[model samples]
Target: MDILSLAKSVGSRVEAPLTDLRTVTKVLGNPHMPLLLALSKGFVEPVYRAAFLASAASSGVLHALAVRPCDLESLAERLRIADEDRPRLKEWLDMGIRLGDLTKREGCYKLRSLPAKALAQPGNDAIAAALEEVLRFHVPALLNAPRMLREGRRFSLDDQDGLVIARSTRVVQPLVEEAIARTLDRDAPVRLLEVGCGSGAYVRYAAELNPRLSALAVDLQQDVADSAAANMAEWGLTDRVETRQADLRTLDAQPQFDLVTLHNNIYYFPEAERVDALRRAHDLLAPGGRLLLTTSCKGGNIGLEALNLWFTYADFGGPLPQADELVDQLRQAGFDDVEATRIVPGEQFHAFTGTSKRVAYA
Candidate 1:
């Protein structure tokens, strides 16, 4: 159906007058038009190169060029792009130019200003690496959607390495930190417990914000736990934060924490297990303590929705409940004053806060 031509025709018709019902009906009948156009524009070349460039950036090719422009031969040698793959690598570098991640001048390729900064800056580097990890770990599962649905088997994200988790934590920690701050009183001393604490970024941020804050972070994977501990040491938060490798289900239910956080990890649990996990978080909170849950709710963002599709098919990861549904679950788990705020409206990110119903008697 010559999708590109159809896309062009649709683009040309957007402003056309369609007062007549027949004309409106005709325009809307071709539902595939918008889908084709979006796929052609958003997913075809740009997304393909974004994945390639992210990989290059992670493997130090972009960072090397960020230091100085280099010819194809020098770049191949420095990055160890195999001898036979040099030509294909050069083509990818050229594609990076077209993708706006690189610039070519006098037979040399260099990182563009934005890419240079992203490769050089630690925060930006982490985000870039995280994006690469998405392409690596998440994209394959998504591509296998047909098989997953037919087989009813889940993809295991538990096998993803600690570096991916660490990088992913850095990517989202800033927004999560802001959300947590908005929900809690920053001045008060608090004990925090974080489940699925990837790299311990949230714990470190909270403890650094208030000297009175201390935290216990739990991760299921030993490697991830080690990485989180190392990050805590790097941030000088080791004294204030302790990390343990343990499954949330197995963790002892103790009312020790003032703020129990479950961030971006809810979908890891199956539908049946989700409520129990929330109840566990509730149990961990002391009297008057709060349980703060942050995740992308179902719908809203297209990219997130697509990822949720893969997660759903995979079994372990599934669609997140809508904000209202989550609020109801918190209430059912015996939480009080349950409220949810969409931190990024129309983008699926939300923070749900609920208070432990236990009250201290005088």
Candidate 2:
């Protein structure tokens, strides 16, 4: 059948019997080729570049390149690429050079882009891990949402690396640190209960902020809790802080903590149970204790939006919370003097603080 006849029969996205490639390619040129290519350069190139950056970061290429220039053979050896794969590895590095992220001179490759260098530096590991998260989880969700939903396939904990998540969530550390500082008593002896304490960084910050502060950092994952415990020991905080593998929901509500914190893990609970979760945290607090929470709320950049999309198709977690809704949840959970503040400029990231009213929920 001719093309026009086929279009009439099959409708807009024409699907019919197998046809000749020449029949389609020969008929017409894309009249908007110039605009199309412009948009392609603007949009398409970034996706490829992002994928490249994420891969490079995850594979330690960006860090190695940022440290020093390497000949192709040297880079291959440094990355431990097999002899058979060295040629393809070289080709990939050549693409990085083409993307303007790497420079080659005198048979040596080095980081060329400011982003590549910055992402390779210390304290920016979270940003690099965030890139990895986008590549592994967000991109897959975006590309396969329809098929996944149709097949009833859902994202589960097994699909994601918790260690990478622990690293990536540190992208919001500065905001969370500020919140902790504002809530923590500077000179008083304060007992803290931290939920989902990734890396034990905040506990460290809190300890630094107040010499008399002691903490019990809890995480749902045993390995994470153990790692945090090791870090606490390394930081000379073993005498002050303790790390435990426990869920806040079922944790023994000792009600001895002067302050309680839940950072970046609210979406771990279903929306219906968030209030109850907060109440549980509240129950862990002593009288007149303060509760501080920080999270990337719904509606931000593409990454944050993609993160929300991730949980929408997740079997084990809920979507990112709305700022207003979370505040309401905090209040409903029997927290008094509730206040919410936007921590990151021009982003939906927020910090919420409330005081314990000492109400026990059934």
Best candidate (score: lDDT): 2
User: On residues 1-362, what C-alpha lDDT tens digit does candidate 2 reach at each position?
Assistant: 75433433333223555376555443334455445455556776698788888888888888887788889898888788899999999899999998889889999999999988888786689999998888888989999999998999999878887778888899888889988887889989999999999899999999999999999999998878888899999999999998989998899757899999999999988898899999999888988899999999988888889999988888877999988888899999999999999876787888999999975456
Give the runs in model 2 whose Cα sits over 4 Å from its true position.
1-36, 344-347, 359-362
What RMSD does each model have against the real structure? Answer: 8.1, 7.4
Q: lDDT of all predictions, in order shown?
A: 0.78, 0.86
Model 1 is weakest, by summed lDDT over 10 consecutive residues, at 114-123
User: TM-score of each candidate?
Assistant: 0.77, 0.84
What lDDT tens digits, residue by residue, belong to model 1 across residues 23-62?
5466557787678777877878676776866777777887
Q: Model 2: clashing residue pairs?
A: none
RMSD of 1: 8.1
Best of the candidates, TM-score = 2
lDDT of 1 at 92: 76
